[model samples]
Target chain A: MSATQSRPEPKQDEVYSALASARRPKPPGRLSMCLTFGWRGMLKIKHVPEQLIDVTLTPVLFLLMFTYLFGGALAGSTSEYLQYLLPGMLVQSVLFTSVYSGVALNADSTKGVIDRFRSMPVWRPAPLAGAVLGDSVRYLVAAVVVVVLGLIMGFDPGSVTGVVAAIALIVVFSFALSWIFTTVGLLLRAPQAVMNAGFMGLFPLIFLSNIFVDPATLPGWLEAFVHVNPVSHLTTATRGLMGDGASAWEIGRVLLEAAALAAIFAPLTVRLYRKAS
Target chain B: MSAQLAIEAVGLVKTFGATRAVDGVDLAVPRGAVYGVLGPNGAGKTTTIRMLATLLRPDAGSAKVLGRDVVAQADEVRSLVSLTGQLASVDEDLTGRENLVLLARLLGFTRADAKARADELLEAFGLADAAGRQVKNFSGGMRRRLDIAASIVVTPELMFLDEPTTGLDPRSRNQVWDIVRALVAQGTTVLLCTQYLDEADQLAERIAVIDRGRVIAEGTPAQLKASVGQGALHVRLLDADRRDEAEQLLARALDAQVHLEPDPARLTVPVTDAGRATGAIAELSAAGIELADFALGQPSLDEVFLALTGHPAEETVDEEEAA
Candidate 1:
């Protein structure tokens, strides 16, 4: 220990000077702080590229397996089913990816990183908003994966503008949907628990919707739920946008639902975030 | 006038469900010095620091950091103080440089400035070589250094270090102590929370001993030691069997109670007069109690805690079960 201690230590003085010379810069604007946190989220993904597996692989696998397994049984033909299933698959893929936002938030909370953020002078919601914003990239990636695989599998959308519009609508809905999971993330004690609850809630919503089959084929009681399900509305709106121009009413209704989810859950999430220990 | 104090709190309280984590705690920490809140695990040290740092709202009472109310002017307090939490608050998934850069950007530095500041901090903290590696791969000491570096990105007027050296090696702990000293030399007041008595004795100008959600004792290290006694004589017997006889003889010679240590072969006697310790040792030797070792030194904070609270300082308490 004495031998090591005898070595010249220049960094100690440098540390002192560094501390003495520090000048407080004007705090960044709320948007900049959010962007900085968003950058941090992206950096996490970059460092651990395996995080992209769920967003990329899950969508592609669902697209491949669902189109092949259910095409003849449900839609009467593979190519025909491809056109119908592609947009809905996009919706499922993006919505499934949204659960990760809450999971990541819960993980951050447990790890004490959120305490660091809370102690900072930055805008209170910047971390949550920034996480949702970062998850938007994952939503986009999942949307593209499903759509590009659909094009490869002989599904024809007929117009580039329609596909773009469909992808945009699903991403918007996913963004709004992320707030619900963020709320769950703050409420739950563990990331795994948040993930389990998110998937448990989403499974029924996605499976009962018109994503996989025609609602007309379902029993009356089940079909009633399929008709009113928000995910069903989102899938229908996405399918209409990709296949033909959607009605203003249909698009407007989906947008309204997204707005409503955001309005209700975003505030709730912020409140939970503020109170989270 | 209150501005001269780094922190002032009155009856600050925080409860989690049924547990009163911090109940009616008060603190007055003067500026530009390290003030230690010493306690074992789950002693409300973290909870109290959390409230002062504006991370947790006090259920009752009020705190002013740098003369700004923690609850009402929390943003101002946050801008003025930084908390390096008990947990390594830096993101483990990011590189050391990235963590510093992220904080610097959030603190309002431009792209170039953030990078420059991050690199400077990395270099100064001896993390320059590990800057590009993810923090999850860093050693415990490296991670702690980075956490402290993250706190001082903007040189907060007051910094809350909750158990800064809790699980660190002795060398790393000394490094952290040096950093704390350097920060104070640069005029940044530090609120250091630690379970290690020596850490508080080495760095803090004043110490507050907290237990069971309250401050049990507060003073300078010397004052706390003096309160326990002037000094103590610690003797280890070569044979554990003869310890009882030695304890009786030592108590008779020193005119003080002999404390049987858990070691079975060792006994501790608090002595106000150094002259009496020498006489007690002679009496022990005269009784044919073979001595393995003996030392006379000022009362350690452990003895101080024992004398003050009737329990050792390191006894683990489950006060933070709810937390």
Candidate 2:
């Protein structure tokens, strides 16, 4: 290196030759592309492990506070409330965690990496699908925290298989719900805006549903709203799976709602994403 | 016809809420050479590039990138072109190596091949040492080098370098120039958008000077410079107080308007005859004004813009607010 320059000369000739000799490989299948983006999301978590703090802390605090503070007053005993409140807590925790899907998308868009991904020849929905897939892992983490804490606090389920089924149902529902937030993310310009809107919309659905108390305990008008709330259906379905058993019709309705959300918002998110810039 | 040209955009228009950022801009960039799109800030350079790259849909008109319609065959166009944006497009949270690997994997490389290519690019760009470090912590130069490396992980027929060296130091800028030259040498057509005149003069064989969403002038660097004047006479004064006196004296002696530079001690006069310039220097000497430096050189791209647009190249216009 000369005194005029501090850095080494870039190996330009070698770079050109490498580019010249290399062949463009076959583009990956859609699934692989989505998974690669999922891997990217996981890498972000690895670099900043604090991304999981909300997933862990939210459930712990919500579960403990709801079960102890209001449990005796509502259900006659903390242990009785734990059995009912734990299933609803799983729904609330996973849905709350789903808000990050939109926040992360907004962050990516603002950072300009979304341009890089969009300009590439990969599947159009791969990035969005992969991000939600990555977030499913967080949903699983939240479920695990809630379930494990419930058991230690004296909540019991009918069977281990039932608990597994219940966790799987909630995770799938959260995955579907994440697309709605991703659409919100694409519509808003800032991550903070997306987070705010996501939670503001969710607070009513989470608190006004059967998560912490029975919908029957409410007035007729409020109960009607809770009965129709998708979060309430998801919570009830989760409770049935983890407790005695839920009806096929009840489980089917939740799956239909999840599917409908994915069907509507996935395409909506992709459209907004394509038109974003 | 499109085979010989890497990009052909005609009357492309893009408006953002009443602001026509790119208005009827047309471009024909030939293959295997650096085609410079030179403009100042908010001159619709980025917007025009975005429309051509298929990142933003044009409000009207059409574009063909590498002989394929950009809108109709966007996937094919994406397959054949890559854009290194003005902003660092790589993931800041990921390590330099991880960003490259991620792009490579997205480009269809196998797991092993992606790592190998990432390593090769990091080494070639002189970023081997910082490969493991997060990109957010890298210097502007390092981030720029990594961004370019990310673009070339799998080479395309054409590359869009948007202000690639905008804020880099001279050494890093030179390194980027070298990398760009290498890419062109290997048959990669580069559409380089830059505000720096010399960067265009050094790298581009043909230059398009766009101002306010239109191509005001298009020619080779020499032709564009010649359009303004044959040459410029630059004079630096020993005493800053005598600049106005020198400006008037030179304007009278040389029979041309003197352009005052931002430096109070310096002024430039566009000159066509060397004999008249010498007479102006003598006129300055007769006035007892000492000279620090004087040189007659080809009109730079800045002067060309000043001549064509009635304003200097550094003068930003209303388009910036929309941008």
Name the top TM-score candidate: 1
**Residue-level lDDT for B156 in candidate 2:** 82
Write one digit per residue (lDDT tens) for candidate 2, span B255-319. Answer: 88898999999999989888889988988998999999999987665677788998877645324
lDDT of 1 by residue, A1-277 (tens): 1212233222888898788778989888999888888898899889988989978999888889998998988888988988888889999999999999999999999997889999999899999989888888888888888888888899888789988898899889999999999999988989999999999999999999999999999999999999999999999988998887799989999999999999999999999888777
lDDT of 1 by residue, B1-323 (tens): 68789999999998889998887899999999999998878679999999999888999999999999999999999999999998899899999999999999999999999999999888898888788988888877788889999999999899999988776777887888888899999899999998777788899999998887888899998788778888789999999999888988988888888889999999988898888888888877887888999999876656766888998765453333223
Two-chain complex of model 1, DockQ on C-alpha atoms against the true structure: 0.57
TM-score of every model versus the real structure: 0.95, 0.94
- What range of 10 consecutive residues in model 1 chain A has the weakest lDDT sum? A1-10
Q: Compared with the true structure, what per-residue lDDT tens digits does model 2 show for residues A195-275?
A: 999999999999999988888889999999999999999999999999989999889999999999999999999999998
